[model samples]
Each structure stands twice: as C-alpha cells, then as structure tokens.
Target: MVEIVPYENCYLSGIVDMILSIQRDEFQIDITLDDQPDLLDIPAFYQKGSGNFWMALKGSEVIGTVSLLDIGGGKAALRKMFVKQSFRGAQRGVAGCLLKTLLTWSASIGISDVYLGTTTAFLAAHRFYEKNGFLEILETELPPSFPKMSVDTKFYRQMIKPSYVLPKRADLEGKK
Candidate 1:
C-alpha cells in the first residue's frame, strides 16, 4: 500500500537519493553537493510563507516527492515532482494522490494557481499534466541552474480555484 504524508526528517536522505537516481537514470542531469537543497529547506520555505512539500511512501520506503512553491502573491509553482521508475503502473497512483493532496492544501491556504516547467523529453509527464487539467503554456526563460542545452522545453499551468475539480474516474482510470 502507498501513503501520502507530510515529509519527515528521516525521509530526507531517501528523498535526495531517489531524486539523484532519477536525475542520473532519466534526465541525465548531475547535481553537485552545493546544489542539493536540504529537507529542512522545504518546510522552512513553507514556514516562511513561501511553499510546501510532501513525500510519497510505500511502507517505510520513500518513492516520490512534490513541492508547491509560492512564486509570489497568490501563485504557486508545482516543482520537483518525481516518482521512481520501479514504482510505475498501478503504483503510479501515488503521484496523483500526492498532487491532489497538494492541491487541496494549496486551496486551503488560498493559492489559486499552480505552474510547472518541464523538458520536452518528458512527453509522458506532459501528457500526465494535461490529463490532470494542466494547460500547456509557452516556455519562459530557463532557470539559471538549468543548462542551456535544450530548446524544446515546455511550461504548463493549472488554475486552482475553489470550484476547480479533477476528473475523478478519469484520473483513476489513468487515461491520457
């Protein structure tokens, strides 16, 4: 069984490890030690009225993570979303659960929109976001940390209103 919960101190190392693994295996990105953000940084951002973070777990294993970063005003950016490759298929539902939980939390805190930036290489991810009602938007300037390597990057945004509703059965059905 999978569980979505607030990040705990013990889960930090696992989260970082999984992120590093995904970067190495899937994205071919290398993150240096200084570039690594501490787990406390996540909650600290939220505590400072910046953003929120959560983790996904199966039993005692941390498999995925998502962050809702307050870009300013009432806007929040959905960033650093990832789930381990080994946990795909039905296990992928954990990601959706985490996203829904984050959206609910954002709504409670008055954030009315969420934005995301991803690379075109991740076609599956783009489709997943679309299935979840996120709209494709034009790409903005790449983040300073991102290598100027790709010109096919994409950006997406989703409005988060009190009335915003996810397709209940469709999301469960995993149809893109």
Candidate 2:
C-alpha cells in the first residue's frame, strides 16, 4: 500500500532519487539536484513557518513528493511536485493524493491562497491543477515573495478556506 507522510531526514536520499528520475529520466528536464538548493536543506527551507514537504512512499521507496513554501500574508507557493510514472494517473492516484494532502494541510493552517509555477512542458500538470480548482494565472499576479523558477512559464492559483491558526516560527523551531 502507498502511504503519504511528512518528510524525514532518512527519506531524503530516496526522495531526491525519485524526483531526479521523474524530471531527468521521464520528463527529460535538463536540471540537476544541485540547481535546487532547497532539496539539500529541506528542513531549513521548508518545514519552517508555514512551509512543509511530504513524500509518498511504498515500503522503503519514495514514489512521489510535494512541498509548500509560506510566502507570508496567508499565501503559499507550491513546489517540487513530482510523481513516478508508474504511480501516476487516475488508476494509481499518487498525484491526486499528494495534492490533496498539501491542500488539506494548507486549509487547516490558515493559508488562503496557494500559487504554483510550472514549465510549459507540463501539459498534464496544467490539466491536473485545473481539474482540482486551480485557475490559470498570470505571473504578475503572484505575490512578491513567490519564488519564480527559471524554467517556469505557467502559473496557477487556488483559493481555500483556512480552518486553524497558523503556527509561529518559534513554535516550529528545533522540532524538525
């Protein structure tokens, strides 16, 4: 059975491998792990303030990953969503599960809007986001704090109802 859980240090290697495989091998994106500094220090970059990362694992292997970075003002930027081809599509449900997990967490933690940037090559991703209520948006509409990747040519946004108070930075410190 596939299980979705918060990221842990022990799973870093597997998560990186899965992401690299999906990007380089499957999608043929000519990017390296070194280009993504956040992958090197997920705990510091994500998992702080309103940011978070998660993994979808089957047994000891990571099959998918996703992350949300808090850009302040009740807004977040979605990042690093990749799923192994074997676990993709409606039949497998990996991508949908990971997205739902992120959105649910965002709503519970007082996040009002979630934005994402993607490359033009991700046609399936565009359809996926649209089907899940994310509307196509212009880059200019993104928050100032939104991190725009060099390869990103498309943007999307989704509004949600936040249910709980957001945790303070101090509350998350030293708890990784």
Candidate 3:
C-alpha cells in the first residue's frame, strides 16, 4: 500500500474510475457518475464543515475510497465507500484502513453520529460495518440531511462520543 490520504484533484480521475468499476462491474450495481454528482466535485460536496473525502492509493492509483459528509448538528453521512475487488479482505485491509481513517477524522471533528445506506447485495459490507460497531437502523431513523440514494435499501448508524479515542491514522496510513 502506498498510503491513505485526503482527496486531491490529482486523484479525481482514478477515484471515479475505481468506484464506478466496483459498483457496475464487480458488484453489478447500476449506478452512474451522473447519478453521483459528488464524485465530479469532491471538494465542494464533501470537503466542507466537518466533512472530507479520502482515497487509499497504490502509488497514486486509487484503490479505495470513503467520505464523510457533515449533514449538520454533529451528524454526518458516510458515503462513497468502495474498495477494489483485488484489494479487499482482512489481510489486505484496504477497507479497514479507509474506515479507520474516516472514523478518526469524524471523531476529531466532533461528529457524534455517522449514518450510511447500502443495498442488500453487499453482504460482506454489512458484516464489516457491524464488526466496526455500526448498528443497523431503519431509514426513518436517519436525519433529514443525509444524502439518501435511490438504491440504498439498508441503513446503519455509528455513534461517536466526543471523548472517544480511535486509533490515529498513522496506524494504517503508510504501512505496508
């Protein structure tokens, strides 16, 4: 792994290509970049307030992504979390690295609740989120500002306490 870092314009093309590949090719999810406008302008959509976007890179080739969108009132929506098929697993730890990075940033920014929505097709993802303390919840429980996608059928929320101590990004940032 090269490193996990904050999103930069230099990574824009790689990010979109990798995510769309995973969604459409690997997972067979019919989503388009037009349907996801955030990918086109990540800084404007995700890099404001307490929100931010990140990419896991392999020598500048984007292999994974995760974003935190600050909805409001100490709440944020976890979005655009996708990992390439070849780079996923407990051993590879690409997904873990991305989630850890996002959580650490969310806690630092005083985000108390992080919500996310996904389809039932991602069974592994459900287990991963549950393993990381994200409890399953109904869509009605989500806050008004969460950017709910049309394909998202299942929802979850992870609560972060102000004084919570999550491992620092360095734990996985540059490690190989």
Candidate 4:
C-alpha cells in the first residue's frame, strides 16, 4: 500500500534520491541538486505559510513527491512532482495521489492558484497537468515569484477553491 504524507526530516534522503533518480536516469535531465537549493532545505523553502511538501511511500520506500510553494497574493507554485516510473499509471496511482495531496493542502490553506513549470521534454508531465485541470499558459503569464528552472519551457496553472479533504485510512480507522 502507498501512503501519502507530509515531508519529515528523516525522509529527506529518500525524497532527494527519488527525484534525482527520475530526473537523471529516467528523464535524462542534466541538472544537479547543487543547482536546486530548495531540494537541500525543503523545510526552509517549502514549509512556510501555505507551502508544504508531500511524499508517496510504499513500505519504507519513497516513490513520489510533490510540493506547493506559497508565493503570496493567494498564489502558490507547484514543484518537484515526480513518481518512480515503476509506480506510475492508473494501476499504481502514485502521481495522482501525490497531486491530490498537494491540491487538498492548497485548498485548506486558502491558496487560490497553483502554478508549475516543466521542461518541454516532459511530455507526459504536460499531459498529466492538463488532465488534472491545469491549463497550459505562456511563460510570460507566470508570476514574478514563480521559480523558473533553466530547462523549464512549459508552464501550467490551476485555479483552486476550497474543497473536501478525503479522509485517510487512519482517519477512517480512528487512528491518530
């Protein structure tokens, strides 16, 4: 079973490994963690105001990640959305679960908009965002605070409203 939960200090290494594996080995993106400071200090970068990071864990393995960065003015930026190729697709639903986790958190925290930037090479990513109600937008449309990566050429946004947060299995079972 896969569980979606918030980022914890102990899970940092797992999160970093998951992202780097996907970006380097799967996507062949020539980027290093050094160039992306946020991944190094997730709490300082993402755990403020309406921001948060989430991971999809199966057993003790981190298989997916998603982040919502509070950018002020009722807006947030989506970042670090990656799922291990083996756990992707409808059967596993790791990506969907991670996205739903972030969107649910965004709604709870009054985030009105969520934006994301991806590389043109991420064709599946573009489709995933679009399927999840994110509209494709020009680079010029992104907010000034949106962190644009060097390889990012495609951008997307999703307007959000407060909605129901599905209860977790623990919640249903009356576990803390």
Candidate 5:
C-alpha cells in the first residue's frame, strides 16, 4: 500500500533522490539538484503560508511528490509534480494521489485558482492535466506573481469551485 502524507524532515533526502532520478534519469532532463534550490529546503520554500509539499511513500521509499506554492491572494502555483516511472499510469495511481492531495489542500485554504508550468517533453502530463480539468493556458494568462521557470513552455490552470469536493474515484479514485 502507498501512503500520502505531508512533507517530513526525515524524508528530505528520499524526496530529493526520487525526484532527481525521475527528472534526470527517466525523463532525460539535463538538470541537477543545483538547478532546483527548493529541494534543498522543502520546509522553508513550501511549508510556509498556505503552501505545502507532499510525498507518496511505499514503506520508507519515496515514490512521488507534488507541491502547492501560494503565490498570494488565494492563488497558487503547482510545482514539483513527479512520479516514479514504474509507479506511473492509471493502474498505479501515484500521480493522481499526489494531485488529489494538493487539490484537497487548496480547497481547504480557499485557493481559487491553481496554475502550473510544464515542459513540452511531458506529453503524458498534458493529457493528464486535461483529463483532470486543467485547461491549457498561455504564459500571459498567468498571474503576475506566478513563478515561471525557464523550461516551462506549456502552462495549465484549474479553477477550484467554492463547494469543492474531494473528487470521486474518477477525479482520483483508487489512488494511493
């Protein structure tokens, strides 16, 4: 079984290793930990204000991650979404679980819009975002405070309704 939980100090190394491996090894993205300073201090970067990070763990092993960084004024930027290659796809549901957890937290904190930036290389991610109600958006559509990464050519936005419900199995059923 898998467990989805808030970021803990003990899992810092696990989270960094898992994400770096998937980004560099699995996706062949020519990036390093130096390029992602957030990984070095998850609590300082994401755990303040309305933002937070989560981990998908199977036993003590980190399998996936997602984070919501509150840009301010009930808006947020979704970041650091990565799942292990072997644990991906609908059957595995690791990605969905991480997303569900983030969305649920967003709703709880009165977050109105969740925005994300991704690279063109993640075609599967584009489809997944669309399936989950995130519409493709232009860079200009982003909020002034939205943190746009250099590699982020594709962007998406998902609006959270006032009466948000933790999505049914379809939104992320059988996840985790």
Candidate 6:
C-alpha cells in the first residue's frame, strides 16, 4: 500500500534517492547539467514555511515526492514531482494521490492557482500533467536556471478552480 506523508527526518534520504535516481535513470538527454537541487536545500525552504513538501512511500521505501512553494498569498508553485520506475505500474496511483493531497492542502490554505515549468522532452510528464487537468501555456523565455543547451522546452499552468477534479485513489485502480 502507498502512503503519503509529510517530509520528516527519516524520509529525507529516500527523497534524495528518488531524485538522484530520476536524474540518473530518467534524465539521459542532457549530461552537461544536473537538474536536481541539493537535498539539504529542501529542508531550508520547508523550514521557512515558504513551501510544503511530501513523500510517497510503500512500506519503508519512498517511491515518489512532490512539493508546493508558496509564491504569495493565494498562490503557490509546483515543483519536484517524481516516481521511481520500479514502483511504476499499477501502483503508480501514488503519484495522483500525492498531487491530490497537495492540491487539497493548498486550497485549504487559500492557494488560488499553481504554476510549474517543465521540458517538452518529458512528453510523459506533459501528458501526466494534462491528464491531471493542467493546461499548457506559452512561455517565451526559459527560466535562467534551466539549461540553455536544449532548445526544446514548455511551460504549463493550472488554475485551482473549484471545478478541478482531484483524482481519487480509485481512478488509478487497475492501471498499470
């Protein structure tokens, strides 16, 4: 069973491992730069209450994570969402659960909308966001930190409207 929990002491390493695994296994297109932030940096932001973060776990192992950085009152930005490949098939509902939990928590705190930036090369990621009701928005200039080596990229946004359907755990039932 998959469990979603707040980022706490023991889970930090698992989160780092999940991110490094994504950087190593999933991000092969670019070797000139590392896409992940330092693990230690995560807690500083969370500790400042500038953001909220969570981890998805099966038993004692963390398989995924997602975070929301509060941009301001009624606004937050989505960041660092990833799921491990070994845990990918039918059990992948954890990703949706993590997202729903974050959205619900954001709404409770008056976050009106969430924004995120991602690469066009991550087609599966784009599709995942679209399936979760995110709309693709044109971003003319890439973020300064984003690698300049790649010409292909995209940005997306999702308004946290009441009509948005936060996927239920059942939605991923039987999906492999």
**Model 2 Cα lDDT, one tens digit per residue, 44-145:** 999998889999999988999999999999999999999988888988999999999999999988899999999988899999999999999999999999
Per-model CA lDDT versus the true structure:
0.73, 0.92, 0.92, 0.90, 0.92, 0.71
Candidate 5, after superposition: displacement of residue 76 in Å?
Answer: 0.3
Q: In angstroms, give how far residue 26 of model 2 lies from its true place.
A: 1.7
Candidate 6's residue-wise lDDT over 17-59, tens digit each? 7776675568754532244443567766653444788888889
Q: Pull out the clashing pairs in model 2.
A: none
Any runs in candidate 1 off by more than 4 Å, and if so which? 38-40, 140-152, 163-176
Deviation of model 3 at 143, angstroms? 0.7
Which portions of model 2 miss their true places by more than 4 Å? 164-176
lDDT: worst 10-residue window of model 3:
163-172
Candidate 1 Cα lDDT to native: 0.73
Q: Tell me each candidate's RMSD, in Å, in order.
A: 8.7, 7.1, 6.9, 5.6, 7.3, 9.1
* Prediction-by-prediction clash tally: 0, 0, 0, 0, 1, 0
C-alpha lDDT of candidate 5 relative to the true structure: 0.92
Q: How many backbone overlaps does candidate 4 show?
A: 0
Worst 10 residues of 5 by lDDT: 162-171
Worst 10 residues of 1 by lDDT: 142-151
- Candidates 3 and 4 compared: the better one by lDDT is 3
- Residue-level lDDT of model 4, residues 68-155, one tens digit each, is 9999999999999998888988788899999998988888878899999999888888888999999999999999989899989999
lDDT of 4 at 175: 65
